[model samples]
Target: MRNLTQTVTRWAPTGTDAAGDPIGYTRTEILGRWEESQQLFTRSDGTEAVSRAIVYLASDVAVGDFLLQGSSVSASPPSTAWRVEAFRKVENLRGTDSERRAML
Candidate 1:
Protein backbone atom coordinates (compact mmCIF):
# COMPACT_ATOMS: atom_id res chain seq x y z
CA MET A 1 0.00 0.00 0.00
CA ARG A 2 2.76 2.42 -0.80
CA ASN A 3 1.03 5.72 -1.49
CA LEU A 4 3.31 8.52 -0.46
CA THR A 5 6.67 9.98 -1.39
CA GLN A 6 8.82 11.73 1.21
CA THR A 7 12.37 12.81 1.81
CA VAL A 8 14.59 10.93 4.26
CA THR A 9 17.64 12.69 5.57
CA ARG A 10 20.36 10.86 7.46
CA TRP A 11 23.49 12.09 9.11
CA ALA A 12 26.50 10.94 7.14
CA PRO A 13 29.76 11.04 8.97
CA THR A 14 32.20 12.41 6.46
CA GLY A 15 35.01 12.81 8.95
CA THR A 16 35.81 13.77 12.50
CA ASP A 17 36.61 17.27 13.68
CA ALA A 18 39.61 18.30 15.76
CA ALA A 19 37.71 17.22 18.87
CA GLY A 20 36.72 13.95 17.20
CA ASP A 21 33.09 14.95 16.79
CA PRO A 22 31.08 13.61 13.90
CA ILE A 23 29.35 16.06 11.55
CA GLY A 24 27.41 16.54 8.32
CA TYR A 25 24.37 14.87 6.76
CA THR A 26 22.93 14.44 3.27
CA ARG A 27 19.28 14.27 2.34
CA THR A 28 17.78 11.30 0.50
CA GLU A 29 14.54 11.12 -1.38
CA ILE A 30 12.44 7.99 -0.89
CA LEU A 31 8.96 7.06 -1.91
CA GLY A 32 6.91 5.37 0.77
CA ARG A 33 3.49 4.99 2.33
CA TRP A 34 2.92 7.69 4.92
CA GLU A 35 0.24 7.35 7.52
CA GLU A 36 -0.61 9.34 10.61
CA SER A 37 -0.85 7.06 13.61
CA GLN A 38 -0.71 7.04 17.36
CA GLN A 39 1.36 4.09 18.55
CA LEU A 40 3.66 3.48 21.46
CA PHE A 41 6.90 1.60 20.88
CA THR A 42 10.17 0.89 22.61
CA ARG A 43 13.18 2.42 21.00
CA SER A 44 16.44 0.60 20.24
CA ASP A 45 17.96 2.35 23.24
CA GLY A 46 15.27 0.82 25.46
CA THR A 47 13.42 4.11 25.86
CA GLU A 48 9.69 4.55 25.48
CA ALA A 49 8.55 6.63 22.52
CA VAL A 50 5.23 7.59 20.98
CA SER A 51 4.98 7.58 17.22
CA ARG A 52 2.82 10.20 15.57
CA ALA A 53 3.44 8.98 12.02
CA ILE A 54 4.63 5.91 10.20
CA VAL A 55 6.30 5.44 6.85
CA TYR A 56 6.58 2.18 4.96
CA LEU A 57 9.27 1.86 2.34
CA ALA A 58 11.58 -0.62 0.63
CA SER A 59 14.73 1.16 1.74
CA ASP A 60 16.13 1.11 5.26
CA VAL A 61 16.32 4.18 7.47
CA ALA A 62 18.02 4.64 10.78
CA VAL A 63 16.19 5.65 13.96
CA GLY A 64 17.55 9.19 14.01
CA ASP A 65 16.90 9.98 10.39
CA PHE A 66 14.47 12.75 9.42
CA LEU A 67 11.32 12.25 7.35
CA LEU A 68 9.71 15.03 5.36
CA GLN A 69 5.97 14.96 4.67
CA GLY A 70 6.28 15.32 0.90
CA SER A 71 8.71 14.79 -1.94
CA SER A 72 10.65 17.99 -1.30
CA VAL A 73 14.19 18.36 -2.61
CA SER A 74 15.38 21.84 -1.77
CA ALA A 75 18.70 23.51 -1.16
CA SER A 76 17.61 24.24 2.39
CA PRO A 77 15.99 21.59 4.54
CA PRO A 78 12.42 21.89 5.69
CA SER A 79 11.60 23.39 9.06
CA THR A 80 9.14 20.70 9.98
CA ALA A 81 11.29 17.59 10.30
CA TRP A 82 9.96 14.39 11.75
CA ARG A 83 12.60 12.39 13.48
CA VAL A 84 12.40 8.63 13.17
CA GLU A 85 11.90 7.16 16.59
CA ALA A 86 11.90 3.46 15.67
CA PHE A 87 12.49 1.31 12.62
CA ARG A 88 11.89 -2.35 11.72
CA LYS A 89 11.74 -4.54 8.68
CA VAL A 90 8.67 -6.55 7.86
CA GLU A 91 8.66 -9.83 6.01
CA ASN A 92 6.16 -11.23 3.59
CA LEU A 93 4.19 -14.43 4.19
CA ARG A 94 6.91 -16.27 2.30
CA GLY A 95 9.50 -15.03 4.82
CA THR A 96 11.22 -12.67 2.42
CA ASP A 97 12.01 -9.09 3.24
CA SER A 98 9.13 -7.05 1.93
CA GLU A 99 9.25 -3.56 3.37
CA ARG A 100 10.70 -1.45 6.14
CA ARG A 101 8.50 0.47 8.53
CA ALA A 102 9.66 3.60 10.32
CA MET A 103 7.94 5.32 13.21
CA LEU A 104 8.27 9.07 13.39
Candidate 2:
Protein backbone atom coordinates (compact mmCIF):
# COMPACT_ATOMS: atom_id res chain seq x y z
CA MET A 1 0.00 0.00 0.00
CA ARG A 2 1.07 3.53 -0.73
CA ASN A 3 1.52 6.16 1.89
CA LEU A 4 -1.61 8.15 1.32
CA THR A 5 -1.16 11.61 2.77
CA GLN A 6 -4.31 13.43 1.79
CA THR A 7 -8.04 13.20 2.23
CA VAL A 8 -9.96 13.82 -0.96
CA THR A 9 -13.66 14.45 -1.10
CA ARG A 10 -15.58 12.89 -3.93
CA TRP A 11 -18.97 14.07 -5.13
CA ALA A 12 -20.55 11.07 -6.77
CA PRO A 13 -22.93 11.91 -9.58
CA THR A 14 -26.63 11.73 -9.01
CA GLY A 15 -28.84 12.40 -12.00
CA THR A 16 -29.79 15.98 -12.64
CA ASP A 17 -33.28 17.37 -12.37
CA ALA A 18 -35.53 18.29 -15.25
CA ALA A 19 -34.20 21.81 -15.07
CA GLY A 20 -30.69 20.50 -15.68
CA ASP A 21 -29.53 21.37 -12.24
CA PRO A 22 -27.70 18.84 -10.14
CA ILE A 23 -30.17 17.18 -7.84
CA GLY A 24 -27.83 15.90 -5.17
CA TYR A 25 -24.52 14.16 -4.63
CA THR A 26 -23.34 11.15 -2.71
CA ARG A 27 -20.25 12.42 -0.96
CA THR A 28 -17.39 10.15 0.07
CA GLU A 29 -14.07 10.73 1.74
CA ILE A 30 -11.07 9.02 0.25
CA LEU A 31 -7.68 8.76 1.80
CA GLY A 32 -5.23 8.72 -1.03
CA ARG A 33 -1.90 9.81 -2.39
CA TRP A 34 -2.52 13.13 -4.07
CA GLU A 35 0.00 14.55 -6.47
CA GLU A 36 0.00 17.71 -8.53
CA SER A 37 1.08 16.94 -12.02
CA GLN A 38 0.49 17.85 -15.62
CA GLN A 39 -0.86 14.96 -17.64
CA LEU A 40 -2.97 14.40 -20.70
CA PHE A 41 -5.85 11.97 -20.75
CA THR A 42 -8.85 11.16 -22.92
CA ARG A 43 -12.32 11.95 -21.78
CA SER A 44 -15.36 9.77 -22.25
CA ASP A 45 -16.47 12.04 -25.07
CA GLY A 46 -13.24 11.34 -26.96
CA THR A 47 -11.76 14.68 -26.09
CA GLU A 48 -8.34 15.31 -24.63
CA ALA A 49 -8.09 16.81 -21.16
CA VAL A 50 -5.12 18.01 -19.13
CA SER A 51 -5.23 16.78 -15.61
CA ARG A 52 -4.02 19.05 -12.85
CA ALA A 53 -3.82 16.40 -10.20
CA ILE A 54 -3.80 12.66 -9.81
CA VAL A 55 -5.24 10.77 -6.89
CA TYR A 56 -4.41 7.18 -6.01
CA LEU A 57 -6.70 5.24 -3.73
CA ALA A 58 -8.08 1.81 -3.07
CA SER A 59 -11.65 2.85 -3.87
CA ASP A 60 -13.23 3.25 -7.23
CA VAL A 61 -14.03 6.66 -8.67
CA ALA A 62 -16.54 7.43 -11.38
CA VAL A 63 -15.70 9.48 -14.40
CA GLY A 64 -17.84 12.61 -14.94
CA ASP A 65 -18.08 13.08 -11.22
CA PHE A 66 -16.41 15.81 -9.14
CA LEU A 67 -13.53 15.93 -6.68
CA LEU A 68 -12.57 18.58 -4.16
CA GLN A 69 -9.82 19.23 -1.69
CA GLY A 70 -10.92 17.66 1.55
CA SER A 71 -10.34 20.88 3.45
CA SER A 72 -12.43 22.79 0.95
CA VAL A 73 -15.33 20.38 0.76
CA SER A 74 -17.99 22.21 2.70
CA ALA A 75 -21.76 22.75 2.45
CA SER A 76 -20.98 24.02 -1.01
CA PRO A 77 -18.03 22.84 -3.00
CA PRO A 78 -15.35 25.24 -4.07
CA SER A 79 -15.45 26.86 -7.50
CA THR A 80 -12.31 25.00 -8.49
CA ALA A 81 -13.90 21.58 -8.38
CA TRP A 82 -12.01 19.09 -10.49
CA ARG A 83 -14.18 16.91 -12.66
CA VAL A 84 -13.03 13.33 -12.94
CA GLU A 85 -11.81 12.99 -16.50
CA ALA A 86 -10.59 9.42 -16.46
CA PHE A 87 -10.13 6.40 -14.27
CA ARG A 88 -7.64 3.56 -14.46
CA LYS A 89 -6.75 0.59 -12.37
CA VAL A 90 -3.04 0.36 -11.76
CA GLU A 91 -1.27 -2.94 -11.61
CA ASN A 92 1.94 -3.85 -9.87
CA LEU A 93 4.96 -5.48 -11.44
CA ARG A 94 3.51 -8.81 -10.30
CA GLY A 95 0.45 -8.26 -12.50
CA THR A 96 -1.84 -7.76 -9.53
CA ASP A 97 -4.22 -4.88 -9.02
CA SER A 98 -2.56 -2.22 -6.92
CA GLU A 99 -4.72 0.83 -6.73
CA ARG A 100 -7.41 2.93 -8.35
CA ARG A 101 -6.21 6.10 -10.03
CA ALA A 102 -8.33 9.11 -10.83
CA MET A 103 -7.30 11.88 -13.19
CA LEU A 104 -8.68 15.22 -12.13
Q: Each candidate: what lDDT?
A: 0.71, 0.79
Backbone clashes under 3 angstroms, per model: 0, 0
lDDT (C-alpha) at residue 18 in model 2: 84
Candidate that would win on lDDT: 2
Candidate 1 is scored at a TM of: 0.74
Tens digits of lDDT, candidate 2, 11-88: 876778888767778778877788889899888789998989988876888887788766544543457778888998
List ranges where model 1 is wrong by over 4 Å: 1-22
Measured by TM-score, the strongest candidate is: 2
Model 2 accuracy (lDDT, Cα): 0.79
Candidate 1 lDDT, tens digit per residue, 32-91?
877899889889989998889888875888766677766656543456767788999877
- Give TM-scores for every candidate, taking all chains together and pairing residue i with residue i: 0.74, 0.79
